[model samples]
Target: MTDTRKSTQNAVGAPGRAADGLAARLVVERGAFRLDVTLTAAPGDVVALLGPNGAGKTTALRALAGLVPLAGGHLRLDGAELDRTPPESRPVGVVFQDYLLFPHLSALDNVAFGPRCHGASRAEARAQAAAWLERMGLAEHAAAKPRRLSGGQAQRVALARALATHPRLLLLDEPLAALDARTRLDVRAQLRRHLADFEAVAVLVTHDPLDAMVLADHLVVIEDGRVVQEGTPADIARHPRTDYIAHLVGLNLYRGQARGHAVQVDGGCVVTTTEDLTGPAFVAFAPGAVTLHRERPAGSSARNLWRCEVAGLQSHGDQIRADLTGELPLAADLTTVAAAELDLRPGATVWATVKAAQTHAYPA
Candidate 1:
């Protein structure tokens, strides 16, 4: 079988002379789980594979590293094909989750191992190793063994070793997963700088949304072995196509942005609000917070009101997810019959309101 794939990215940056990239249409088959994915990363571009646990993110990374064989499809780096190449023969570097340093070797020797395997002279490899160690801020610990190093130090050493060989592609599997929360923050910043300087393709598999958003310019979100959503963080945040992504994209998720005593929409449209907040802020009310009525409330405490057109409706468990497009775009969840009673259909404009007490403001 043949599959057509596209880079799905604008080729704005010309590949530099230092490194090209690694691309793959990977398929792996097993008893109950199968992964089929396609990805292309630029020379300095970091592509993050994000998903929940057991979502085939790691499976895909392993397939690219040749730890597991591809059931079908092709793998390429720069302009060369690498489908049949052995893991060691492939011009790829891997930083596993465990930061698997040699127990008996010093930090410097571990970093030197890759260069040595690549046929550098022992002295040359040691010299290169020293340089890498210093680059990772571990020059003083060159003689320290893995057992003596802290978790963050060990992680940096693993990264230094991966880069020492000067591989064409780098594969990092949950690089920050092993670190403590405090260490993670510092290492994450350091890793970002290193990746920025890396002139090769880098693919990182992570379940953490923060990691994916911080480290990758392009995001490929996989679920059940399929590419569910792929886009920039801003695009995904504004228009969440899936519930999982909705949570990942932080939104106060309010019905209105609170003003002094009113909220404005498009074309001079305004809704009087009871909330009293100054400066730039937001007002939040949930889908479940809204209660629909057959007609506008004659006299009520509800201050915010809108004539909304039902853009779309989706079923989420027992509740209904409603998309409304009118003066302001909004997503509201209501019960099944409430939607039916209001006859919420596309293009049907209905009066929607929320109490001023319900509105809230937070720092943007």
Candidate 2:
């Protein structure tokens, strides 16, 4: 393990350096799969790990909390090396997806459990737990058991318990995955406020893009156990580098060769963009930018047009999303009234047009 760590450090060019907040290059191996991700964040920063299932998001969280052993690399928090520390001795708190509160214990006792485990007296632990519950707005349910509490109330109690431990690093795994839509809204806002007030580093693992955008200051998108992209929410939404990210941000993306203002994309289709570029490039546009016509209109001002066949249709809020395939495969959004007027259906033929100004092209 020591040799592996040395090699990893040499490869990445950073080792044995102490820094404030959380800095880690997590490397874990399981059978045929390996996860190697480097993450750094300052105090009061909320970082989210987002990816599809089996992408090692949960594994990264577990490694940070000392629940999984690191095969290589280093783990440091506030200038302290914790690669060999046991889970119980690490200054970390974890909130699982299921809110694993003791079923037989009252809310107050559940919150006090951590303090008591850390050698606090009964009175001191209860006092601290009471203060935390009050802060979470669950003081009225102090005596209620986990089974008797609402989903949102139980989640608060779990958070209070984790916070009571005075951990420097907090880990949340799918924190809002268990809540209903309405309850999730309320709890998400509350969690964001609490995270902002927290003075330590927090790492959240979730698959929901909306949750990541709403709660995290930084997003690390992992795919196949590697860090594919990392950036602020707005920056990522505007410039997506991968197909998964483009889908997550609701954009049609393609890669091709660029010559001046025109890009020759896949299937021999050319896209005209306002930005002039050369060499390898990427073109992206939103579904709303596409206009569908039953017949190819001559003398149209649009610079980009495609002959397509409707592959499918789905409802998107007040609009209808038409999936097209032929010369170019893409999605188009139109009002229900417009869709009816065009008589759009599966296997129907249509001509799609997108203005050059609406297409964004950049270096790949």
Candidate 3:
């Protein structure tokens, strides 16, 4: 309910702003794939659509950009209904997975294409294009063709072109995906800065948890073409609704019953919670929340503690991921230094505890 038009103009500033701006709620259908998503992105909000393959993530993005038809739902931007609007008619910019720059055109020319198509003179388009390239730190590459540019440079050129259009909404489909692992880290950092500077609503689709966690302020987790969960990165990381989401973020979640911020597990063990939900519910704790010990503490007042044996171990960052099998299976992450101190290894007996504050519960 803010003054969306004025907000759009101020957010994108001069370089990234089009005439007005965008908001979209699109429902699309095709063969066996159906996408029904509702999104309200502000001028500067970066909402990430995350899911596995075939989860209709790209389908929803396509619908919003007008590349795909809206079988249902309506898209609005700057107070205009765009569900039936042609892709070109909507004030939206899209950067595809691959930087689809024209091989024959110089970076500046490619960036100028949109302004030209919208009826700007060649000189005017080139003027605007030059400024955008300079803003992206690609001023030297303005005369370079697609093949002459590095992957990250090409990506910036593509982004410059997209923003040059002055779109109210920007859509990036796996923007950093084409880069290799090392390149990905570099580009991802650069992309984060670019996205932060973008004033309008920018939506990105990615299967990478790190990408979603790092780049997006809000995440919409899709599975089987439906939104299974939507929240901030911390919320999703701490309280995953489904096992798939849990595994993606490397957490463990269990559904059970809760009575006053406490949940009873299937094996008669009770776990404390941080939620107020009653009746059937879910209790989640992160792997880092579970501290492993070689022996149970004699005078510990911990609410939920278990003695288990390590079934597996894997390296996760600077820490060790210990997979334990006992009354109920659990995964715990501890520093490599801690593991070394405990002398923990596969088949080792360990004690795990869940601090009451760490256990989160909500209605299932």
Candidate 4:
């Protein structure tokens, strides 16, 4: 119901405010759940919708592509209304989460299908499809069936199919969700390169913070079917407004009332922050900033220390991450050798300390 176009402005593309792109207000209802989100992207911009599962990210994408009709609000591309346009008729292309390549068709045929549907002659469609496959570096697999192609190759074919239509707006739904860890890295890099080459407006839905940060020009964080936060990836990572985002960014976050350098968290402990913020404030710090000791230290300069019991521990890359709960619930990262020397494990009591300067405080 709110028109946030004027309020939620970020520096878009080189064209500034005059650039042609997508501006959509999506409203849909399914029984008790209602999704209402406003999205904007200028040409040459790649916007990533980042959110938890069931937060209506995919529904918003479907609404824009006309796969699902809007119960209310409007859909526009450039300056044209497309609320009534069929999925195939709109200048929008989609790369579905599953890739959704036809099992019976060859890679070339699959990529050519979109063009063929738009009245291109078979020869023309196939020629365009071939060019796209070559661009994707999958020209050799043109004759291979979907089953014969690797996961990364199939993903490229799906992208090629979506781009072959010459759409003004591109929608990608969890484009790398299906790939394995190793394949995802390569596919993600390739996808980023292709996205950079695209000149139109593109919107992608992803729950991974790293994916959004690496692939998008702007991040729109959605929660419970509404826009919770919107900004550049760096801005969001530095100052997360919500606990979910903080967790996603791998930081321990707390909301409290701040007076001078101290913030009284709702739970019990008072966190010392570098900034002197007032009223409602948030304190956040990375796990790496926390130093864990098996016994209390005698002459530590750390202003914030918590006597916590290790609730769990896990391997995070080359470091060990410890989950602690007591006076202040937080996570700490230590080297594997340090973890071994400290003999850290579940239910171990430890002292955690963080310097005041390491904690960041901002208006909530």
Each model's Cα RMSD: 12.6, 7.4, 3.5, 5.4
What lDDT does each candidate get? 0.76, 0.90, 0.84, 0.89
Over 4 Å off, model 4:
1-19
Q: Clashing pairs in model 3?
A: 18-166
In model 3, the runs with Cα more than 4 Å from the true position are 1-23, 181-186, 266-268, 274-277, 294-301, 337-349
Give model 2 RMSD, 1 decimal.
7.4
TM-score for all models, in order of appearance: 0.68, 0.93, 0.86, 0.93
Clashing pairs in 2: none
Q: Tens digit of lDDT per residue, candidate 4, span 5-70?
A: 222222121122344699899999988889999998877789999988999999999999998889
Residue 311 deviation, candidate 3, in Å?
A: 3.1
lDDT, residue 293, candidate 3: 80
Candidate 3 overall lDDT versus native: 0.84
Candidate 1 vs 4: which has more lDDT? 4
